[model samples]
Each structure stands twice: as structure tokens, then as C-alpha cells.
Target chain A: MDRATTETKLINGYQHEFPLVPRPFQRIGESLGMDEDEVLALLRDLQDRGALARIGAVVSPRTIGTSTLAAMTVPPDRLEDVAALVSAFPEVNHNYEREHDINLWFVVAAPSENDVATVLHNIERRTGLEVIGLPMLDSYHIDLGFRLPCG
Target chain B: MNRIAPSPAIDDLDRRIVKATQSGLPLVPRPYHALAETLGVTPEQIMDRMRRLLAKGIIRRIGAVPNHYRLGYTANGMSVWDVDDAAVAETGAAMGQLDFVSHCYHRPRQLPIWPYNLFAMVHGRSREEVEAKVKKIAALLGDREDGHDILYSTRILKKTGLRLVD
Candidate 1:
């Protein structure tokens, strides 16, 4: 197969149900008609090129610990500073600037609910902005839905 | 996943395994064996633990997580809907069934200032595509869709997976 086709197959085919055996890359290599080293190299290259985050497990949120989607409205001028402050917290994982009155949005994952609360409270105290905590009451999707389009 | 049950059953070994592989699995020929050596456990034990984690839904899936940005999915929108509280479960489930809706959650509605209870993350190559997908969600919601807004991510300030501390 060509390089493009090989990459497309590697990414699209193994997004889910990746081989669970001890030699998973070898298993994947067998399926993709490549050697174990080839599969590993391709994956490493993808990671280096910023195409692949990692060949790992996507853990379910709030399963082991607690997490919440929190948002804050930061002044446009202070958005960068506030975002830096929010992102500085190790508990804060995902942070984004959305186009809304409540512009600063983030996800805080901690060992416990109290830890999550503390992280949010610290953000509130530091940024001096009220943080709206929106914990997932119920999830409707079946896992992080199949993403990444086949090109 | 549909049932987001809080499983308080995860133990120390499980957390260790999670910490070891949360960022990404080893890219070696024998990844499990590598994990086993590092965690001071047998390869069989590591594999067994991973299998159980998978069955228990603790590990959603073990695979490649692609970077959507690199794949040209530039427009990321968080579509929030103020639907009838009573009908939220039904509508949210239906919205999640769509191939385009990656994440759908029914969260609490902060009165007055914030009223959206249903949140679905939609991604597209452009704003128009994302808006069109959001329109489909609106159609699905029908009368239950009291109000809605799409919060397009202007910038990705930070994006990283969960990191458990010792």
C-alpha cells in the first residue's frame, strides 16, 4: 500500500478495539501487512509529527476520580493572563477560549470531588471570577464518538 | 458511554496501571511486557488488569488517539441547548446518536445567567459545517429545544488528558 493509504488504515482501523494481546503492535502489524518495528516506527513518527496524541487507552471521565467542566467570563484584555493562571493548575486539564460571554472554559480532573472543588475555588480566588461548575449529570454518547475523518 | 456510573472500585494497582498508560501505551514490540517490568508485575497480570479495566468501562478503548487539528478539523463548537429538563435524557440520547456529535452530556442549568443543560461537542472543517450540524441537533430537539448557543473555541489555551498525582 502507498504511504497515505497505510497511514489512513493505521489510524482509522485501530481507533477502537485495538489488539489486546501481549504483542499488540505485532498483532496490528500482522493485520496491516507490516512488521512490528514498522508499526512502532510509524506510530512514533505520527506522534513526533503531532498527528497522534498517543497509542494508549482513553479513560472514562469520573470513573477513577472526579472531573467537572467549568467556565469563567474573563475580560477580553485579561483573557490571556487569566487563561495562563487557570492552565497553571495541574488539576486543570483542558482549557479553551470560547466565543461567548463566558469565554474561558476548562476541565478539572482530580483524585476526588473535593479536589476538583478546591481547584475551581483556587481559580475563582486567583482570577476573581465566578466559576460555573457543570459536572456531567448524564453522558449520552457511546465513548468519545469515532473521530478523525479518512482522507 | 450511556451509563456514566461512578465506579469507586478502582484500587492502587489500577491507578498505577492508569498512570503508566494514561499518556500513551509504550510503542515497543512487547508493550504489555514493558509495562509489566516498570510496574513490578508480571506481563500476564498487566494484561489481565487491562482486560478487566476494559470490561469494566474504566478504559474506554485502547488505541490511537488522532489529533483532530492535524486532520483539518479546525472548527470546534460546544453546542449547548436549553431543553426541557424532563425531556433532556431522551433528546440528549438522540443527539448523541448522531455521528457528528462526539460528546453529549446533560449538565445542570445555572439559572438566569446560564440556562443550557444539554452540551454536545461538534467538530467540522469550518464554522459553516459545524453550524449545519448544530442545526440538525436543533431539528432533533424540536420543541424541547427551548434555547441554544454554539460556543466556538476561539483558541485552544490548553489541551491535555487527565494526570493523576501521587
Candidate 2:
């Protein structure tokens, strides 16, 4: 794959304005002087290369109910076992570890405040480890999108 | 010619639709209708197209994005776990069952630089409360429990939709 082509087709493709039509991508292609297939191919290529994770809605959970960010500290050898236990819950939307002792981190979303508590409790019982439940008390901004410069 | 199903092409219009609805469906009474008017298409068309996008997997989900801080909770932590590959699916399912866990998934262990694989986010009102929960999770996984960490979000730089092209 041509790095220049990938970068041109994808990085440059990000800045294009969004169309406000039923077939918005079609219009977008027209503006870019490329067909819909060309635009999509570029996106797929990016995904294959791991540049783009997935294109999806970034909806706020607060509008629906309650949520939180919780983490834990597990023994180095038991990392795999603990992660498997933590990921078993359906409410967890995003989970990642960082360079720290308390590494197991995850996000839990529930329909209500009580549900969050119950989920935490369940994790505790199932995993036999204290599952920390850190509900978000404030949010500065919840948008994760970024505009990559076209090189 | 032997043919493989080519990925669905995302045209400019699709990107626009995603951008429009990415943030959310308008809070107005006739949000879909309003969007249709703006897009110069019928509301039915917009709805149908959205449905198609969902089916195509281009759009993972269409729902509300909550602001937890505004709702009276603030402490947020990213919990990472190193789970056995065979048990990851099972463990992830268990973690997903928790209502407090908003996000959970299995990521490859990057080793050295990044070792933790399975990850989840837990939110709470206070650090103590969050810590209390973590203690409980440690006991649940038993022998499989490995080193874990709590990388609290000191500052949220950006959290929004994934721009496909960029």
C-alpha cells in the first residue's frame, strides 16, 4: 500500500465538509471529485491499517441514565484472569490499562444509579476481587473526534 | 471471476449523515423531520438510510451520550486487566453485565510498554467509593488476577466520534 495514497485519501479526506442529505456521502464524493466507492475504500483501508478504529455515534450516556470509570490493581501474573472477569459485564463500553499499579480500568453504563451499584457488586462476587466503581462526577467534554492534518 | 464481497463504499453523503447525527438526534419534537428538511430529503429517507448504516456496521450504535459530571458524579477511572485469551470472552461477558461499567473490550497486550489486555471503565462519586469496588473485583477473578492499574482521567483532552478519513 502506498503511504502517500493512504494519507492523501484518508487524512485529506477528513477535512471535507459533511453533506446534509439522505445520500450525504454521495454529495461528499461529488465535492471531492471522487465516487462514493473511492471514499469508502479509503476508510476501509484506514481501518485495515489500524489508523481508524470505527466510525460510530458518540452519544452521551448521561441523557440515558448513569455511568462511571473504575479501575483495579491485580497481581502481575493474574492480569489475564482479572481482565476476563471484568470484561464479562455487558454495561462496560470501554476498558483499557495504563502504566500503573491500579491497571485494570473499565467504563460501566447502567439504566439507573442503583444498577451501577448492583453491577459492581456482581463483579465483586464473580471475580472475588474488590471492583472499584468510579462514577463520573463531572464532564468537561465527551467528544473524542480529532482532525488529522493532510500531509 | 471469483469475487469477494467488497466493503460498502462510504460516499460523501454518508459521511455527512454520520456527522449530522453523530452528536445525537436533535432534542426537538420532530428531530428526524427537522433533519430531513435540512437535508432536502424526506424523514423516511433519513430514517431508512440510518438503518442501512447501522446494518452495514459503519455506525455501531445510535443513542444518547450522557454527561456524567453534570449528573453529580465526577471520579472516573480506566481499569485495565490482563486476562487469559481463552477466558477473556467469558470475563468480558461478566464485566459487561455490570451496569456501572460503561465500556469493556479485549485489546492485545502490547507487552513491555503495554501489558494489560482487557479493559473497562468504572465511574463513581468518590475515590474511596471507586477503590471499594476495585477491592471487590480483585477477589472475584481469583488466581487469574494479575497486575492492574487505575489511570484516572486527570484531564479529558478529547472524546468524540471517530472521523473515518482523517
Q: For candidate 1, lDDT tens digit of each residue in A1-151?
A: 9887888888888988888788998898999999999989999999999988888888898888889999998989999899999998888889999999999999999988898899999888987889999999999986653555555
* lDDT computed for candidate 1: 0.88
Worst 10 residues of 2 chain B by lDDT: B157-166
lDDT of candidates 1 onward, in order: 0.88, 0.57
User: What interface RMSD do all candidates show, one decimal each?
Assistant: 1.5, 16.3
What are the per-residue Cα lDDT tens digits for candidate 2 across A29-143?
6766767666566555655664554433543434334566666776768877777776666666655554466667676766566777787888878767766655533322222
| Deviation in Å, model 1, residue A117 alpha carbon | 1.1
The candidate that achieves the highest DockQ relative to the unseen native structure: 1
The fnat of each candidate, in order, is 0.86, 0.07
Task: After superposing candidate 2 on the true structure, give the runs of residues whose Cα lies further than 4 Å from its correct spot.
Answer: A1-151, B1-12, B55-58, B164-166
Which stretches of model 1 miss by more than 4 angstroms?
none
